[model samples]
Target: MAKKTARIKTDTHAVRLQTRDDVETAIKQIGDLQRQLEGLAIEQNNELAAITEKFAPKITALKAEIEPVQQAVQAWCESRRDELTQNGKTKTGSFNTGEVQWRQRPPSVGIRGVDSVLESLRTLGLTRFIRVKEEPNKEAMLNEPEIAGTVAGVTIKTGIEDFVIMPFEQEV
Candidate 1:
């Protein structure tokens, strides 16, 4: 029987050039860097989206909140300015009718010409001074020059040379 010959092996330098370890190391480093970049990108995107969401609605809501207030303030300012800047508008029809009717006031009357000094008192406001005694010139009550006007249907007379001011008392 012939004996089987063993095959001879050669350590070729070229065949050993590309080792599995070097290839594995390079692949591992590349994979790690890729994973880190993906993580950083996801984190950045999340942060930016959150920041945008936080302020975007707030800006609109602030305008919505302030719009009515701004309009109201503007309206108030315009009204006040118009009121302060009043132009003279001559109101018709109700002239002198109720202009002096708002509140009770003292009455007075004035006179123009007369013969006697007491009879020249054309205007008189006070009815109380009607029956009062005269000063300096002592004269009879019925002999004075009668300046006549009425108060509450009661006829009053005075001889003063100036306006007679009535007491500021009236019925409601």
Candidate 2:
């Protein structure tokens, strides 16, 4: 006679358990997602910084451009005030204007800037002096060949130098 071996079957009510490999894989996937997110954040920050850096110079340059124009206006105003006092002294030998018309030709360029030069040359204070007339005098000094260069046309005044330009057509 042969001996029979006992057999047993496991029950379905036992708890399921996870392996170490599964836990490690989940942790690694989370770490990878966090690293990707951090990289994206850094890239976005760099792009923003580059854009701001590019515009900074243009903004500064624009401000620089306007400074010279402002300076020109300031110089013009200071010159006008000084001219008023000196011209008054020369004409009346004193500052007494109780009965004078203050409305006489408001300082060359709007009652402001470089009065002495304008007075000396009998011109209104302006960046350029151009004849507003449509036609030039045919027999005037502008037509003369000798001294025409001196009084021919508009005078351009920059801080560096003064320029005299003549043109067939007047600038309106």
Candidate 3:
């Protein structure tokens, strides 16, 4: 019988910037470095996704098995919360586990029939009590010269306007 052997290996290399004596050359080198890093990041993410895909079925099965137990535990906690608090116990019995306590929250409301309600409020002169929110149309603002000039100052500015780096091959 033969025994299998395990081995560890590494490939290390030094990288130095090769460029002409100018700011533009250095900038180009920096842009190339950024693109290389981005490519490596994408490759690593794809590898991780493949590993996750391999384990997904097992993970889903485990979750399905534990779901009923989780629901039972949740019900038990909710039912016993008042009794536990009354007995001056803010947490569960010490089994090297964390505490669980009930929390108080404000009730939430959902509005329906918004148009009818708005019309009623306007008819009853109760418009002041009703809140109105208005936002500038971004497409119209950008397309119209007058509107664009007016709203450009207050609009959220994004992206590089003057300077941008893109992958480009050197001319022969």
Best by TM-score: 3
- lDDT (tens digit, per residue) of candidate 1 on 1-172: 4333222233333333278787566555555565566569999999999999999999999999999986886576455543433432322112243211123369977655533434433254444444556563324423443522322443445443432212221222
lDDT computed for candidate 3: 0.65
Q: Candidates' TM-scores?
A: 0.27, 0.28, 0.43
Best by lDDT: 3
Off by over 4 Å in 2: 1-19, 66-172
- How many clashing residue pairs appear in each of the predictions shown? 11, 5, 0
lDDT of 3 by residue, 1-172 (tens): 3332222233333335454455467656765676567679999999999999999999999999999987887787778766756665564422246555556588986769988888998999998969868987777765675657665465544442344334343332
RMSD of each: 49.1, 35.2, 13.5
Give the runs in model 1 whose Cα sits over 4 Å from its true position.
1-18, 63-172
Query: How does each model score on lDDT?
Result: 0.49, 0.53, 0.65
Model 2 RMSD in Å is 35.2
Tens-digit lDDT string for candidate 2 (1-172): 3323222233334324388777566555555565566569999999999999999999999999999986785565446644645655533222353311122555555444556655645554453553445775545643564555456573433345333222122122
